[model samples]
Target: MRIRAAILAALLWVGPAAAQSDPAEAARHAAQLLEQAAEALNGAEGARDRVRALTEIIRAYEAGLAATRDGMRKAAIREAQLTAELRAREKEVSRLLGALQTIETTSPPLLMLHPSGPLGAARAGMMLADVTPALNARAQDLAKDLEDVRTLRQLQQAAADSLAEGLAGVQKARTELSKAIADRTDLPRRFTEDPIRTAILVSSTETLEAFASGLSEIAAGEIAATNADVSALKGQIELPAQGVVLRRAGEADAAGIRREGMILGTRPRAIVTSPTAATIRYRGPLLDLGNVVILEPQPDLLFVFSGLQEVYGEPGQVIPAGSPVGLMPGASPEIGAILSTSGEGTGTDRSETLYIEVREGGRPVNPEKWFRTDKDG
Candidate 1:
């Protein structure tokens, strides 16, 4: 049908003008070439859309190709299906390129019947100019996916090595084991708050310390139902995070800002546990702190932990000391940049920082005095 349309258009273009010269004939031929070019362009466009979809599918499969202690999940089935789909997509792209070849290698010779001689041939070279970028981009994407496959293999190897280490140290679990406990606790929720509301309520306050002060009023009725004495555990409490103290109490937070809490640079995936048996006052992302949790160990005493990547406990939940509360997602390049600008908490290059504060009787108190471990001091 495309060929017939090209012929018909060329015939109509052959009017009552001089047909003796090559110029008149070339004009008619150009009309025919344009018709065929448009048809090829349309088909190639459809093929390009299909190839884009195929690339997206390949990337999705790559995303799930993580290494694990149990080995890659559904490895056999996913790999086979991805291979088959890639093969089919490659064929479609090849066919689309073949179909577009007609414009360049016309059997009657496109150059012979052209008015501008070599210039006409050069113009025909640009017939598929629009299609080149799409094809080139897809080619680049294929290369990236190839690299992703290699990365996924490396991840698998890493997971296997980690599993072996964990198995060897099964009986000696202590500090390193905290990350899992902090990150993956399955305690029942006493209550939950909307993250959006908690976020908004926190933003309305001046400082993070002030933001925490308001949370003490949450579940105020439950005050009569509990008994936890954090003051009694002073100088004997365990460190919540395992790391060195980066900033001591009364240190500068940013340019001109003063900090009320002590900042500790903890290892990645460091386990975050409650220092004392306490009831949760609030838990969620706050104004500057990436993720913050407020705990009420007793009336008029609030313990604050900030810079967590994930929190497993909910607001109003009561947990004992050394109980898993959350995980400090180790700071990466992305989060490090955010922390530098957000003025939330200082982050180290490789480790994450957690801001620890103790509020007693409506006032911020020194947190370093509570922990007996070398880490907090």
Candidate 2:
């Protein structure tokens, strides 16, 4: 079967090889994920909750693309290994081929005859029985390796189209999600925003610390009450975005300016979500931080995310866990760029950064302590 067909089959059934660590199995799994994402995109158009549907679609695409990239990287490495092994065994392969060819061409009765007579012939026959199987097994292994190389090549080539399709689908989903969020109503609000007070505070604050300190001053009405407590989930909460840590808290940048927060390197337009159920304390451009979203998941605890191109939700609104907050800045890479870098297995493609800061009692704390930082993208 072709790579694409095999991927579809794997998706429909849990084959024994699906659980293996083989490169081919991994590639097949990746392809299956990409196909599922495509299906999600197709189903999203008719979904009643457009915002939710689009958010899921975008996430699906991201996961599928990431898996595909990993698969391609493994496939490339595996192919190179197979090629190198074949090259190293060239002499052995040639000798085996020559022996097999000689055996095929020689008459059976003549091959059985020996100059040393009947006893010698019987000994020769026993040796041939053992040796013939070894040669055939070696030949089978070599053929399988050659075939695998071809399959890996096809998989990589086929991935180019799947990656392009996934990229476009995600972009479209993001656009739709933005529109949906803009048109959305009925989200629960903890308090009404006082824009005049917010503007005054923005004008008066010189730093993020000062701005965050005065967040309560921007609330105009009586705040709604909530019993949500995420204190037990501390140090277990997932990162709000899919990316690897670029800089840790207190790490100095090239300009020698140290930050209290950590920077995450993410792919362009990666979706940022609420790590847990939280109330939006603030969301917008703040203090040269580009678009920002501040969440209060527990009393006196704040989670700040910045460097987004488009922010979602309104100030004082309560959002559920995994809610889409915003998207990272920059356009998605073109198909050519993706395919070219698929095998490099580096984060060079992650061109955007999201800054994350956790605050306890209005003081900046290390975000790594609050979030699970074990995964690298």
Candidate 3:
């Protein structure tokens, strides 16, 4: 999704001179961003959809943050103007009112009997005519400034109310995103199941490799063959899933335990499509691993997929590039939590962890050297 700036991304309840300059315009812009965020939240569906929604929510919150900070600053400035400069103006107006009162109380006879005589008094009346308009204009100007101050105070209160609601909406959108990732279940399996034998072997294996090895026994007698050239396809294949790779082969886990595999984070039930066409070598549940699917994309080169909740193919089955092979489980830490804890900062927020190993002649090979892009790139 495309991104834009937001003004109401933070709390709005702050000391108010009300809103800042052109508050009405700023408020309208902030309101538009909030509306966009709400629409995104309402239309969100899967992990991708929820992610898009979160982007908008964060943007809106950022906008609110800017708005609130500006509002607070404007309020402070307005208060200072009213207390200092505006207060001085009020005193001047008061003095003008006193002089006008004196002029009105003086009668014509009293003016004619003045020390300077009626001639000077007549000149005073003429001067008064010219000065009255200027005084009246100053009062009007002061009145306009006072009205502006009142309007600013009102704008701030209104902005605060809108921001409060915007903040709540952002939180709600975050919660929904978490829920959508945790509840993913619509996924396709890449390997078939044989419960009678699978159950017996799964219960008997002491380790993950032992269980997958038992399932691999089916391919031991068959001649695995594929026309694709593994060497030619190096660094030209698509990623098995959409995600950010957090660990490479030989990277350590939280306990500092290292493994020979590339660990990446994918959304819940993200499609595990074959990066290239390959014959299924082994597909079944492992001791600690949820489900494992081993594919021979080319002779002596195997693509391993572990930490899946379901498999889609049988032994010797040929799957094409971009074909769905298996599905990942949700973020529940019990059976699937290992995906989260496997890498630092790659926990539940990433949804699921996928362990990918590209082995050549039974030796571990790093996938980073084989794929065009490995992680966030």
lDDT of each: 0.54, 0.82, 0.60
Task: For candidate 3, write residues 57-170 as lDDT tens digits.
Answer: 544443443344344344545645665777776778788778767667978667555468778777877887899888778778878877767775675666555566655665
Write the number of the candidate with greater lDDT, choosing between 1 and 3: 3
> Can you write out model 1's per-residue Cα lDDT over 202-222, one digit (the tens) per residue?
768877667766664444243
Clashing pairs in 1: 178-271, 182-326
lDDT of 2: 0.82
Off by over 4 Å in 2: 1-20, 45-48, 113-127, 194-196, 220-228, 253-256, 340-345
C-alpha lDDT of residue 301 in model 3: 78
Task: Give the range where candidate 3 is weakest over 10 consecutive residues by summed lDDT.
Answer: 332-341
Could you tell which candidate, 1 or 3, scores higher by TM-score?
Answer: 1
Cα error, residue 367 of model 1, in Å, equals: 0.6
> Which segments of candidate 1 are over 4 A away from where they belong?
1-200, 216-224, 253-257, 331-350, 373-377
**Higher-ranked by TM-score: 1 or 2:** 2
